[model samples]
Target: MTPKAARRTVRIAMNGVTGRMGYRQHLVRSLLALREEGGLDLGDGTVLWPEPVLVGRREPALRAIAERHGLAHWSTDLDAVLADDTVEIYFDAQVTSARQESLAKAIAAGKHVYTEKPTSTGLSGALELARLARDAGIKHGVVQDKLFLPGLLKLKRLVDGGFFGRILSVRGEFGYWVFEGDWQSAQRPSWNYRAEDGGGIVVDMFPHWEYVLHELFGRVTSVQALATTHVPQRWDEGGKPYDATADDAAYGIFQLEGGAVAQINSSWAVRVHRDELVEFQVDGTEGSAVAGLRTCRAQHRAATPKPVWNPDLPATESFREQWQEVPDNTAFDNGFKAQWELFLRHVALDTPYRWDLLAGARGVQLAELGLRSSAEGRRIEVPEIAL
Candidate 1:
């Protein structure tokens, strides 16, 4: 008879579970779902189990989540939780403003840290965090969930297969109309519109674009951006009007290291007209692909359509139908959950994980430079960051 695999539980102290992203994606979909799936098997003689200890500022919210998930641990005191030697990992999903300080404390406590981006409010702080983590010799990671998405995965597969030979340009559109709180409650928190609260489209989305463009195509070499506050006045959660001090929309053009150009528009004020809320169209010499959060469509040079340029004639070609849908050769798990598992494995097995604090710092650097570009009305060059 085969011997049973030994189970080792890893206690993770999760902070900011009360936030929308934290509650839905991290707590419920990722961690709890992993718990339900019998944790992660290390492929050795051990199974790594995750034990979540919910920590938040609000006692009621933490207690509620613990009760809902049947979790036995809940704490409002962060220092006390950090002092607990049993807790091996500290996962933070807090807002950008609070993230740096909390992560710093966690690092100081000598705990493995994982967090959402932008890791800090500015590039300097982010670099400092990376430096601190390196000095502490603790396993640290940032959530780069898009890389694990099915659409992006398929797009990556195409890139690896050399389908898009000598990629020329990439275009991306990401946003949806976030309702102003006047008639209906805002979809996002009230703080997202206030610049003082570390809210702005450039700060919020450029970090995302940084990782995506860099990982798939090449390193971003330079950036030219125009950031604007489209909705200057907005209603708060209390049905009171407030000035939207942050940029609600950003139009950016980035030059990649390999000579490819990438353009992306991030907005909170735009209405949805595309098939997906977010989509990227990559054009190459050999082929082209359009990838969204869950779907990817492609068109090869062989199947390229030719249309006559006659302004007098009505359009006849069904351009949307010309592209073929990319097939999913394998099942894909939830991106956030997939990342969580990988980070967990990295903690347990010292597996190769690239999306560390430095990568996250690069994202923050992009956002900072993008904002600076907009402010100075000139292109800003991206410099390599070293910890």
Candidate 2:
């Protein structure tokens, strides 16, 4: 290791480390992986140094996580973690409804903050968090994991290189059936079915899509959406049936800043019948591409063809061979881990990270607009938030 690399270390306090996304994605998968992997290079001679000190719901779970990851510190008290001088950064993977309160406390403690998407359940809370972070003068970021995915990264390269002439529109299909807690012993957490816990596709997934769309295309101007709860009753943690107050699915159409339009379907009640769990098809005037979790394909207009759509016509010709698979050019790792490295670098070296709290608030704005559109039964224009 370089002498300079050895000098810098970023101490992180992970909040909600025992939860699903918290434990798997934020702690073990992202921060711990970085710690085990040594470090990540940002540019120049700077490298990100991640040191995780786990904080979670249960003491036993937190201890197990710490021991398993070879981390020395574990805490059940959020206040103590915030007060610890060694913890320079406070990372939140807490439930959506709890994020605002936790973030407010963390910011008050004068620590840099990073958290999972949707920052908070509503625009007001998200805006408040943004204001608090700004006032605290600490670095803040939200996970925009899709932008860092290898397949999507390749697509971004194509777009930036003008491989796709003038972008037209994007279509995204995201989701799969999450088993009911009672019948299958619960695939997802019970909190995910309760509205009070901030559980819903529109709130959870749109933040991710907003970043992806904004990164690949342009800003969203307006949105029209339809949302529903397919499963009315779901089992809770106690194995008792509770009303599923949150939406299980959301279908939305967005008008981007430019004339380009996009549509996205997010659901927890759908079956996967495609290449991957989530897939996106991006079409531009010059070419088109289809990107999945594991693969990406590009199509040039010159090599593409028009086909007649007839009920009697074979379904195979339309989409089967329209695009060519783009070879994977980078080593693969967890997307959350990749973003974690970036955030660490941003904190340690003042790296130019664009995925800040303002961007996160924009996502909350879209989700709020989607809910408003669904509620009012009319298309709603998304208002811009000052970054």
Candidate 3:
């Protein structure tokens, strides 16, 4: 071994390795990449070196993941991994219902943590986890994958460059039809359909939208929403019909701190007719931009879109064709894998890692407020999160 390569090692213990997110994010994206490529190199021979010492899961699945990732250590005992001196960081991608318990245990064992979004199913649990992490003096972070998307990054640049002057309102359309778990076998896990498992569109996706909204426009102040369950029943892993008790779709309007307005729609059962599944439209005094999943278009006041009631007008010249594709400018990779690299650098090199627990709590806060608004049939003011 090279003298410099043996100097530092950041041991990691990953919890919940059997599930979908666990397999994709932890095993394939994070741990495997770290082991094979030696972690992401920050610069000047400095590298974020990760030593995945323990991966926790059920017995059979744990063994499979160990063999898959070529990991030497595996366990089903959370406490054992936490107690190991070789493990310095604890990562969790468990279901939202179990996130709080796993995180609390990890913190008590005195290890830094990084976990998936919606830190918890509700505001209270999320707040408690944030407090524990702070009191324990351990660095904590949550996955905000949307912030790293190539399309969103380009949009951020436009906003920063004053392309959208004094933004007036923002609109977002996010969703795609998931399987009914019978004929198609359910694209998402069965746990997502169970309210008890913290599975709901609002909780799963609002956290992602929160960061994007805050990043593009500003902080959200008030939210009014309506939530629904389009699919009442879905098949479980065992291929039996189970009644879905969670909201599968949600429509909401948010008032930003700066008086900017945003309308967001999230769904798991909807057919999309757009270029990409997700799209965002931002309007400003000087200009407006329509950002589809893969494309973005800017319109100045001189070129502002016009509307007509007359059916004679020739199909409103396909504006989609007029827009140019925004190029990805950031050097960092995209998606969850990219976030993994950034988090590793943040831990090892003290790089600017602002995606912390408080940001995550903000997401949970929004979800809680949305649910309340829907249930009360009125607009709800979002409470300020105390990080």
Per-residue alpha-carbon lDDT of model 3 for 246-317, expressed as tens digits?
999999999998889999999999998776788898899988887864567677777666766688666767
lDDT, candidate 1, equals: 0.94
TM-score per candidate: 0.99, 0.94, 0.93
Using lDDT as the measure, name the better of candidate 1 and candidate 2: 1
Q: Estimate the Cα RMSD of every predicted model relative to the unseen true structure.
A: 0.8, 2.0, 2.3
Candidate 2 lDDT by residue in tens digits, 123-161: 888889989888888999998888878889888888888
Error of 2 at 106 (Å): 1.1
**Which ranges of candidate 2 are over 4 A from the true structure?**
1-7, 41-48, 313-318
lDDT by residue for model 1 (245-330), tens: 99999999999999999999999999999999999999999999999999999999999999789999899999999999999999
lDDT (CA) for every model shown?
0.94, 0.85, 0.82
